[model samples]
Target chain A: MTEQQTGDVPSARPYYQPPSLTGRPQPANLADILERVLDKGIIIAGDIRVNLLDIELLTIKLRLLVVSVDKAEEMGIDWWKHDPMLTVRERGLDEENRELRERLAQLEGTPDDEEGGQDEGDGSARGRQSAGSRSRGDA
Target chain B: MSDMPPAPTSADGPEPSVPVSDTATNSATNPATDTVTDSSTGQGSEQGTGRYLYAVCRRLPPGALQGVHGLSGEPLELVEHGDLVAVVSTVPLASFGEDALRRNLEDLSWLESVVRGHDDVVQAVAAHGPVAPMRLATICFDDDAVRARLRQWAVDLGYVLDRVTGSAEWSVKLLELAPQAEALEEAEAPASGAEYLRRRKAAVEQRAASSASAADVADDIHATLACRAKASRQLPPQDPRLSGLSGTMVLNAAYLVPDVDAAEFTAALDELRGRYPSLLIDARGPWPPYSFAMLGQP
Candidate 1:
């Protein structure tokens, strides 16, 4: 029975400090709880079928797939990451387009002479695609 | 499917579907339907109301929760099945229904409130005994359905409870951004356009190399921390926008550590923090055994 286990164990005031770079640490925020419950908890789910006559909806699967990227992969759920509909897929395409433009510029004998250069384009993006896409376009 | 533990035998018969007292139905509806209230918590009314389960625990004394409220300020109630007690509350069917969830799940603020409500009760339970949190928004058609689920998952639930009884979770994140760009003013202006292009490409390549090495360093640190805990899991690094942090997030790891061993774990973290002073390392925890409370783990 250590000091860490006692006190309000479930209080928002966490025993461990929130990391500095995470901005203002609100202890356990929505992400923390979500990450925990999504990965842990026992899900006891069933459709609530109302025995009514007036037009009402049928069964629905309400299981939320909200998980961090790594957690999703661990559970074999990476569809959205690869889904052609979402931003992750679109971002990949955008990166491909940018690199092709850069290469085309290079072939046209123009080496980013435009003001602010290619660095400006990179600075505007806070996207994850930039990191992984570098592998393909690298000469 | 492969990860699922051996399925427990369900309730011996169709003895589920507890007939919650729907006083309104006694005077109005068909007797056959009266026996089965579906999932609507209102019992007799067609209005879709059901109990939203937040978490489950064992050996929790009655009235342990007197003031806890769940989503939309509903009184939190406990449905006891054998030794297991599920923490739940009534929620409007129109709001929590499948169609509503499709719209509401995207609303972060709504999700946050519901999660907070869920945590308030779950945490109350965890403080006293082993608790296995349910996924966000698990609604049961009725108390009987909840009981059926309890019977269906009794074995796995017990396993989770026993493992997390004396442990807590910790999150460790590592961020190492590319090193500051080297001041190239010292180099004389390049004599040729090709020379300038070559230099720029080299700089980009150098930055990439450092980022690659930073990732390797983060991996090394995660391995070091994992060795100090009862169990460890690697979660995907959070997006910068979501986390409000700068730099590449190299590691997002969670560890299940016993209360007594927590000091040692922190000590190891501090040692690594000292070793990699330039890296941004965030460690948080003493959380309920979230990452570890899963089925099929020894």
Candidate 2:
């Protein structure tokens, strides 16, 4: 098993050159091009008048297509996490965790067993709601 | 048909004369014509050619668009009204007429090719001098109608050209970092129901606080960059899928910076990147000023 895995690494190396290594202008991504040409620019009425609302809806569809296709390809690879430029420092996480714990303690006070059960239900429900709303804003 | 008189030929004679002779011959052969016929709806009746306007330039350096092709792979030509020159190419009315355009714009692949082709010509003209790009699929019946639009919108076109002459557009987007997986595992398992609730509540509050701070950082970055640019506009954040990156986009903006100030604008960006190491500051530019070329009216 170790030998097979080791052999696979050499084969994959040729196919996966990072874009920055090429030292060329990365072709503008589809989303960037679509947003500029469709959503921006001077709008002079022409002989062929395309409905503005139709263009807006088409842009929305293209955005969704770009997101879903790219997202599926990125699912198992987690490529961005490995990018050196994107690697965030770990120092802030520890400090933030400490602050959060202290605030949580202050909010809960001395908890009883019965109240703890009720608080858990409410907390989890609120967490779900916040997550739902955040995703809604992105859409 | 004789009433329209040979669509005012340009001073240079040869180039504008091609369209002049073509329209004259067209008017003579295709005599199913009337003075009051609506050009937009008369697409099916004539089955003639239409001019696809790419961009209008202040003055194109001689032969700037030498080998560049337009949307239909047709050789590009210049339609000069006065000092203002319109970059155009002949497209068959069959594919580019009003009805055909309505159907074609809905197809994704067709739209992509046309958009790319339009940008290619705009970029070619922009390389030489100031260019005000037309909206996608702005076609006219013939050279006469093309000249008519230039005559009418001369002032606004001049204003757009003046505003974008020496500058280009730059895009800057800031994305917040998603929490690392190991960080979530750092906290030990909860001892009781109360502990679980405490952790959950803390997680929620932490998320809200961080997003708020990220928004502030985005605003600060925009303000700093805007000071270096001549003009700036904040566009709505793009979807993560389209951007091909994860994490919420906090700032999606376009800045119109003079050519001389480009270095200073980028330097400011580098400084901001260092200040907010947690953010992904994606900056790309010197694009044709698509966001800033709007005439006051549609």
Candidate 3:
């Protein structure tokens, strides 16, 4: 162990070494990994340890909070943007938007089937709640 | 091993053994102070002895840790008790003193920074060799206090080091999402109440099956990787908020793999990913052996 910031040496002491040595290499087993993840590992609790609360609440408190983004939007709750790391399923929307724009551009070339294509496109748009439809509709 | 009869108390200081103060902070009050007074008659007189605390262990090679400052920029000291070494620094009695710690520990940020700093140091030490990290918020009032603890927990500490000797931790997460498009399609499909009920039941059964499958896969992943590593241990699943991770965490498990088979464990995870598409498996690590330092010798 290096004692940083202390150039002043204490009284000359005998070099010490612990009798217990643990540097031997071993196989990576389930006991080791499970212990690593669940039992032994660095536990960092910050100003607000939000991440650790989920399991504690669900298991010990027996409380479940399932707030849908759609419902929250209706209630004027803006938790979606609070932490981008916790949000999922947004990629599907982006993929949908690209497909819709591509279809619209393809439809732009045909004049005779304008009304029919528009209706079909509308049906497809209603059928899919993907990002593509949302983006095209907003546009 | 013969107890070296409390290393002849050096003439420089009383009870100068490093172990006394190494873990003095573990008690509710200073161990030395506690032993001096009992509440039988409400006598609170103390023996006026200070303490030293062993926070985190980060192996700073022989010379890498020469200038690192502790919690308050105090000079840090190293107390080597065999192969395992403890990095210690003196904390003012006010911060760690019996009355003050109880009063101030509730301030979450202060406690967090101290714990994190402790962990950072431990990680550094673990990088070099197997480190038996002390629990969170362990302190000692004196060198004698530390040695008393060392004497008390020698066997426990040895066990902890043996379990983590050559292992590294890895994290794997599983997430599942019910696609909006699929839900919309089902809603739009022309069907009777009976058909709708059947569909709902099927969806429930599918969810159950998926959940069971995820568990099996997690177990399999653990088994496959365990074969490559020396030892492994499991941790409770964490919440998304605590983990700072993306997606609903279906399976959040960490594995301790040997340094020699680290690549093999990762490759197994990749193969597991390809084998299961419905459930997303994101793997990270080869991290320091943090999880292996369970309750040491005491």
Candidate 2 residues A1-139, lDDT tens each?
3445554454332322222211123566666777888888878777656677678767655544432333312222232223212211221233334333433443364353212322222332333232212121122
**lDDT (10s digit) by residue, model 2, range B1-298:** 2332122222333235132222224331133532323454445533556678889887676657767877766667667777888877766666777677778889878888888999999999899888898888787765666777888899999999999989999888887654642254357888975576565545645655776788899889999999999899987656554566456567889999999998888888889978988788888877899888988743
Between candidates 1 and 3, the one scoring higher on DockQ is 1
lDDT of 1 by residue, B145-238 (tens): 6667778788888888888878877888887654453444236788775565445545545555676688789779988988888788887555
Please give the range of 10 consecutive residues that has the lowest summed lDDT in model 2 chain B: B1-10
Candidate 3, after superposition: displacement of residue B188 in Å?
10
For each predicted model, how many residue pairs clash, with residues at least 3 apart or on different chains? 4, 1, 73
Per-prediction DockQ scores? Answer: 0.16, 0.23, 0.04
lDDT of 3 by residue, A12-96 (tens): 2232111111122333233223233323433322111123333232222111112223223322333343432333333223332
Docking class of 2: incorrect
State which candidate has the highest lDDT.
Answer: 2
Candidate 1: residue pairs that collide: A41-B133, A70-B236, B39-B141, B41-B49
lDDT at B155, model 1: 85
Query: What lDDT score goes with residue A49 in model 3?
Result: 16
Q: Residue by residue across A29-76, what tens digits does model 1's lDDT show?
A: 444665565444554555543222111110101111222232233323
TM values, all candidates? 0.65, 0.67, 0.52
Model 2 chain A TM-score equals 0.37
Candidate 3 Cα errors over 4 Å, as ranges: A1-139, B1-61, B72-75, B92-108, B178-206, B295-298
Ranking of models by TM-score:
2, 1, 3
